[model samples]
Target chain A: MKIWALQDQVLNPIEQKSIDSFKAAGGNGSLETFGNDPYKQKLRVAIGSPNAPDVFFNWGGGNLKEYVDAGKIADLTPVLDQNPELKNAFIPSVMDGAKIDGKQYGIPMRGMQPVLLFFNKKVFAEAGVQPPKTWDDLLSLVDTFKNKGVQPISLAGSQAWTELMWAEYLLDRIGGPEVFKAIRDNGAAGWKHPAVLESLTKLRELIDRGGFGDNFASVGYDMGGASTIMAQGKAAMHLMGSWEFVNQQDQSPDFVKNGDLGWTAFPAIPGGKGDPSNVVGNASNYYSVTSDSKQLDAAKKFVSTTLHEDSYVQALIDAGDVPAVVGVEDKLAKAPNADYTTWIYNTVKEAKHFQLSWDQDLPADDATFMLTQLQELFLKKVSPEQFVNAVAAR
Target chain B: MQSQRPSSWYAVPAFAFFGLFAALPMVLVVYLSFTSWQGLGTPTFNGVANWSRLISDGEAHASMGRTLLLMVVSWAVQTPIALLIGVWAAGKQRSRAVLSSIFFLPLLLSTAAIALLWQALLDSNFGIFAGGPQFLGDPDIAIYTVVFVISWQYIPFHTLLYQGAARGIPASLYEAAIIDGAGRFGRFFNITLPQLRYTIVTSSILMLVGSLTTFDTVLILTQGGPGTASRIIPLHMYITGFSGFEMGYASAIAVLLVVLGTALSVIVTRATGFRAMSSQQEGS
Candidate 1:
């Protein structure tokens, strides 16, 4: 069997170990990894061709749904039903990411990545301010950072998806996850929801008030532009994924080692409908079997047996990943960067809802259009009303 | 005459290759334009749906406008600088060769490398000009930044063309112009300008069509961002087909590009009388 996964320095070795162990257990397969963008493109082409892999890595939302809808994905409902322990080992919320139409199609394979408000503790200390707990507090802090000659926030606006985190949190806070669920299930008309408009208007006001600063549109996350700015004290805060902690450790070891990295939940909106504990980002990546795999049973066994095993879960924890496996709290606490990892684990465990990123949850065409519109909103090329109207019209 | 011309079989291989690789794919693309395929399974025929969408897509129109602007601005910015440097480099002075070699450095780098290098250098936060104007960020300024980067990358190649043409201008023409009391400016205008006319036409055709198809640089530089400010035709088509998985609509856009490129070359050649070839020396 052939397995495809994303190229990552840390995850690659861990995955290889799992594949090696699977081979030792009388299973056969090799893992091939690719960069993020190229991997997505290659999977789309490969899945429809004769060369499709037996098991492939996927972000488990509308991205996987496309394959499911095409009848190209093997249904894993029976496998989970046959072994309730395998189903119960993973967190229910993260597992639902790959659940479509009440049928299981994928197995959780990696960490939970929830977007958080990460701040430079040293910068916050110099400014004599704490991370905000309310929308109004966030607004005032923006001014405070600007007055101190620091960019209030470091945003990698060159890629629209980075800007998307703000919108995701705001909409979830203001009207709760139901608003986005409507948008996802009902298509473009769902953009007309009042909650979306209100959140975007509020976001626009923040942009106008110089919250992200002027040059954000040029900053990029992948190149370490925004993160470095925040780490070097040029920017006071950065809203990013959990993976950012590892990135900072790699790029600016002194910064992370000094305990200058601080994080918190997104600030609550005044009288918002959603619970403050609700979260958004990638819930977790999954490994889904292709419908046409030659070694279907072995591939299914590989994903189910290897992912939740004691050794595989420990390897993930040691690599700074908070895997979706249930009851790993003590292991996480004993691991490196325990404080941050434990907090994430608890935060996800108690969350009322864990919404997937909208781009990953919506169809490709709508997501692409929404991202462009979102960039225009951030650039002030279009008014909030115009952004809503343009998207709804699509 | 046919017998004297060595068997026609010699041309068979070239025709066969072109037919398979070029002609066949083009026909398939046109067929794809009339069908809906999400880069999966088989395409189902959808008639003129994609064409109708293309006619009304405001984004496509805006992208077309940007592509034309890039072609025009890059041509205007590159032509004069390349011509001047090319003429100067054609001089026999030892310093000219060294300086010319240095100027040709950008041509040595791959498109992706040049784009990534500039992306770092112009990074708004940590770049050389950290606090300066947002060259790659602001929507209004991003497109021009793209044009500037494109010119920086291609001007050296154009300069190489101009340099060769300038050298081929016949030193005898310059000597005669000097004898006729024509100063530097007078000789350049009357002799060099007219002599390099054909080369200018060839370079301009390449420039215009090249800009029309320019993808990787803008893709790597801004990705048509700061809110689709620099999105051009080719990039738009790519995002639609690959990113959005709207292959049918993207094929329609591709067909439009093919038509526009062919028409541009034809118009340029016709307007410049380039088809009427002749020797420009004192005697043919």
Candidate 2:
């Protein structure tokens, strides 16, 4: 049986331990791991063809919506019903994000990636600024940084999805979760909402304010291009997911150690209905058994191992992620950064709503078009109205 | 026709391979073009829904237009410089070998490696050329930068071809031209240009098709962003098929692309009067 997973040394020991146990249980399977790529275009083709892997790893959200709607993955609700430990092991909030109409299709397998505003404290201090508490303050800081000859925000503008966090947060804060809920739950017409237009308009304000400097459209998130700007003190802040901190730690340890990297909620926008505390990101990665799996029993058995094991939850914490498993708080205290881990856990815990990334939330086609629109809006290529109309048609 | 015709059996293996791999997939793509399938269930016939949508897809059209622009820009920049260098190098003795090696260096590096190197060099914060233009950033300038990089790598190839073609011209031709009171420009326009037509037509065809199908480099570099400024036809097709999961519409685009390529190659070959320039000249 082919067991596919994303490449990460973080998963090496975990897989070895899991496979060893599976073998001990008289289960024989072969695992093929793709590299630690955020996007798995090849896997899409593989899963559609006859040679689909028995089980595959994925971020649980609208990312799985297509597979679920097409009946490509087995509904795991029955499996969870029989295995209460598996159902109860993962944080309930994170689990909801992976389901469709209360039916579980995937098992939470990895960490929570809540989006946050990561800032350089030294840059803020040097510029006599603090992390913004309101949208206006964030707006002024864009000028403040520009005056100080620094980029206001380090944006990986070329990678449209990287620029997506800004829109996600801004929309949430301005129009409230209902604005996007209608769009996602209601389909493309959600793009035509006044709140979406307002969100796009506000995002433009940040761009026009010189928030992301003149050359932002070229920068990419991979290989530390945008992070380098932040680490090298060329930019004051970066709006990114929790993984940004870990990436910063790896790319420039000194920056992580001494640059006083900081985190904050996206500022509250005036007239926005969204609670400032609400956040957006993947709830957790998941493992789903393919519908066509020849080794159905083995695949289901192997994937359930993702949740119930305490050591697996602890392993995620050690990898610099704040896992959303119940009874894992004590384990988090032993994390790489206990305080940061707590902040992440609580941030996710305290939020009234947690939005999945639109690109990951919407069906694939709309998501692709929506990302293009978002990137275009950020770059001011299309007017906010045009963006909304274009998306609404999708 | 049966008189001394090469045995058809000799072509069987190649024909079988092409039939299974290339011809079969192409047939599937064409058939799939009229259907709706997201790579999940069996493709259901939609009766030109995919084709009709593609006809009005402004983004795909713009991407195709941009690809044509890339072809024009690359051909204009790469072909002339390569021809000039190839002509000059054809007369050189020792430097020709060294120059050829130096010019061919970019071709050795994989597209991914080249993109990474350029990403660093053009990086706004840490790149060596960061202070200059945003090489891969600014949408207005990004496509041209891609064109420039592509030319930087491929000009050497064209140059080598041109060099071979140029050298194949007899020394007696140039010596005869000199005796006829022809100067450098006159001799070149009269002799070299006429002799290198076949090489030029072949390379131009290659450059056009390669530009239209450019994917890996752009995928690694800009990902066809800054509002789709750098999106070429192949990139558009890949994004539509894989990321969008609109495999039917994407297949429509693919079929259209194949048709376009074939039409272009045929038209270009005909218009250019494409013919090989051999040691024994056939009068044009």
Candidate 3:
């Protein structure tokens, strides 16, 4: 059997060990890995060819749904039904990411990544302000940071997906996840939801107020862009995924070590319809079996047996990942970077709705178009009404 | 003697390779343009839906405009610099040789390396130009920045081309012009410029087509960002096909590119009389 997975230094070694254990357990396979963009393109091409991997790693939601709809993915509902213990081992909300049309096509295989508003604790202290807990406070803090000649927020606007976190959290907070669900399930017409315009108008106001500063459009998430800006105290706050803690730990160890990194849930808007407990990000990555695999039983066995194993889950926590497996609170607390990891674990545990990233939740074509329009929206090239009209018309 | 000439069978391998790699893919792309494919399962024919969509795609139209701007601006910027340096470097001076080698450094680096290098150099906060103008961020300036980086990468190559061509110009021509009391500028115009005409044509065509398909630089540098300001046709096509998984629409865009590229080169060759391939040296 052939398996494909994402390439990451910390994740790959752990996965390699899992693959080794699977091999030792009489499951035969080799793992190939690729960087993010290349992996998506390769998987898309591979799924259409005769050489599709028996087991493959994929983002859940609309990304995987396309494969499922084409009859390319095996329905894992029966496998989960046969082994309820295995099914219940993972967190349900994260697991629901891979559940399509009432059928489980993938199993949760990695950490939960929820978008959080991270701040430079030292910067906040020096500026005599706290991390915002409400929408009004966030706006005031934006001014406070700007007055100190610090960029209020560090946003990696070059990559649209980075900008997407804001939209996801905003829409979820303003009108709940139903607005996006309508867009995802129904089509472009759902983009016309009044809530979308309202959320975007709020986002546009933030942009116009210089929340992200003048040069944000060029700042990237990787290669010392926004992360570095916040780490170095040139920026006061950064809204990013939980993996950002690991990235900061890797890129600027002293900043994380000095206890200067801080995080909180996105602020609540007054009179919002949604619960404050709602969250958004990549829920988790998953492993799915291809329907046409030659060694179907072996592949399914490998996924079901290895992912939720104590050793695998422990290894993930050790690497600073908050695995989506349930009952890992104690393990996360005892692991390295315990403070940050436990916070993430609890935040995810309490979230009323865990939204997969909008890009991952929408079909690829619409997601691609939406990201382009999103960048334009952030650049102030399009107004909220214009953004809504353009997307809805699609 | 006539029997020693190679038979037509010698052309078979070359023809076979071209047919298999180039012609076959072109035919497939054209076919795929007529279907709806999401890069999974079989492509289903959807008639002229994709073509009609392409005709009305405002983004694609903007991308075409950017592509043209990139081509024209890069050509305008690279040609004079490469030509001047190539002619200057053609001299057999020891100092010139060292300087020319330094000028050729960017040519040795991979496209990915060059792009990344410039991306870091122009980064808004941490880069060398931090706090200066937002070279890679500002929408109005991003495309020009792309043009500049591309020229920086390819100018060395075109310089090398012109250097070889310049050296091939007979020394007798310059010597005769000098004997007529021609100045440096006069000698360059009367002897060097006309002699390097064919080289300029070749370099211009390469520059034009190369900029037409320039993808990796913009992809790495700006990613058509600061809000689609730097997105050109090829990048737009890539995002549509690979990122969007709308393979059929991307194929339509790809087919348009093929037609445009072919027409461009043909027009250049025909307009400039480059296909004549006649010798420039007198009494050769």
Candidate 4:
């Protein structure tokens, strides 16, 4: 049995060792691993071919929905039903995306990735500001940081999806979590919604205020370009997902250890329909059994074996991740930074609705199309109406 | 005529290779272009929707303009410089090998390696030389950077091609021109320029095709950011097919690229009056 996984495990070498140990000690039959390096599309092509791996990893929503629709993925509802313990092993909301037509198709195999508004505590202290608690606070901080000769935010503008996070959070804050949900259901009608328009309008304001600074249009996230700015204090804050922490730790260890890399939930919008506690990002990474895989039994056993394994969860925490496993709070307390870990755990736990990132929520083509429109919006080449019209036009 | 005809057996291996590799895949692409599929089972036949979308796709249409712009810039900048180097290096007897190797080193490194090297060197804050243009970030300058890098990598190749033609130019013609009191400028125009006409046209055609389909470097460096400023056709196709999972649409883009490349090549060769220079040679 060959398992295809994201490259993060490769970065944390011991995690692979844990997986290899699981494959050996569990006696889940013979197993092999082939993962990392191949681009997402290349991986999709491989899974679509006859030589598809028995089990593969994915983000579970936009990437997996088409696979499930095409019947190329196995329904994991049966596995979950047969083993209640396995079903209860992960947070229920984290598995919501793994369902297609109300049947589970994927198993939560990695940590949660909720988007966080990370700030530089030293910069904020010097500028006499704190992490924003309300939308107005965040808006005011933009000007305050600029006056203090700091870029308010570091945006990975070269990657459009990083830009899309703003819209996701903005829409969620203004219209609540259902703005994207409605849009995902029906495109044109959803695009015309007042909340959607308001979100785009807000994004433009952020750009106009130099919230991300003038140079943001060229910075990229793939090589930690934006992360560097945030860590080096060139930028006072960065709006990014949980992965930003790990990335910063890798890029600037000094920043991580002493630079006060603080995080808080996205700020609240006044007069908004959205609950302040609503969250958005990648809910979780998952492993799905392919329809054409020859080693179905072994693959299912592999999933079940790794689900509650203390070693697997511990490894994820050690890698600076907040695992989606059900009882991770106590385990997270023992993590490197217990306060940050607890806050993240509580943020996800208390969330009324956790919307996935817009790019990962919409189907693939629409996702790509939407990202382009958002990018154009940031560049100010497209008006708010035009952005909506382009998205609705699709 | 039948008795003089060569046996068809000689073409079997060639034809087999073509059918199994080139012809088969091209046919599949053509078929795939007309249908809606996610690289998985049961492609629902969606007639012309993909093509129709490409026609109205605003970002895509804009990206097409950028791709052609890149092609034009590459042809203008690369060909003349390559010819100059080829002519210069051709005249060098002692250091020809070393000069050629040094010039071709950029082409030898992988695209990923080159992209990384340039990215580090051109980093605005932390690059090797420090503080210059954001080569991979600014949409306005990013495409030009790509053109620069592309020229850097491939100029040696074009130079090598021109060197072959330059070496073939009869020294007798230059000697005759010298006897006629032609200085360096006069001899270059009368002899070197006319002699390299065929090579320039051929290399231009190659360079144009290469520019149209370029992906790896831009993908690594920019991923067509700061809006669609650097988003060329091939990168768009990859994003459409792979990220969007619209394989059929991607194939449509690919098919259009082939048609466009072939059509332009024909038009260019004809416009250049390059209907086989051999015929002109015979006439002279």
Off by over 4 Å in 1: B1-4
Worst 10 residues of 4 chain B by lDDT: B275-284
Of the candidates numbered 1 and 4, which has the greater lDDT value? 1
State the weakest 10-residue window (summed lDDT) of model 3 chain B. B1-10
State which candidate, 3 or 4, has the greater TM-score: 3
Candidate 3: RMSD over Cα atoms? Answer: 1.4
Question: Chain B alone: TM-score in each candidate?
Answer: 0.97, 0.93, 0.97, 0.92
Off by over 4 Å in 3: B1-3
RMSD of 4: 2.9
- Estimate, for each residue in A200-302, the C-alpha lDDT of model 3 and write its tens digit: 9999999999999999999999869899999999999999999999899889999999999999999999888888998999999999999999899999999
User: Positional deviation of B109 in candidate 1, in angstroms?
Assistant: 1.2
Q: How well is each residue in A29-119 modelled by candidate 2, as lDDT tens digits?
A: 6767776433367677777688898888887677787788777888889888998888887778788788886799888777889889989
Best by DockQ: 3
lDDT of 1 by residue, A193-262 (tens): 9999999999999999999988888888875688999999989889999999999999999999999999
Error of 3 at A344 (Å): 1.0
| DockQ value of candidate 1 | 0.81
lDDT of 2 by residue, B228-260 (tens): 889888999988888888899999999988898
Give the range where candidate 2 chain A is weakest over 10 consecutive residues by summed lDDT. Answer: A35-44
Candidate 2, residue B189: the lDDT equals 98
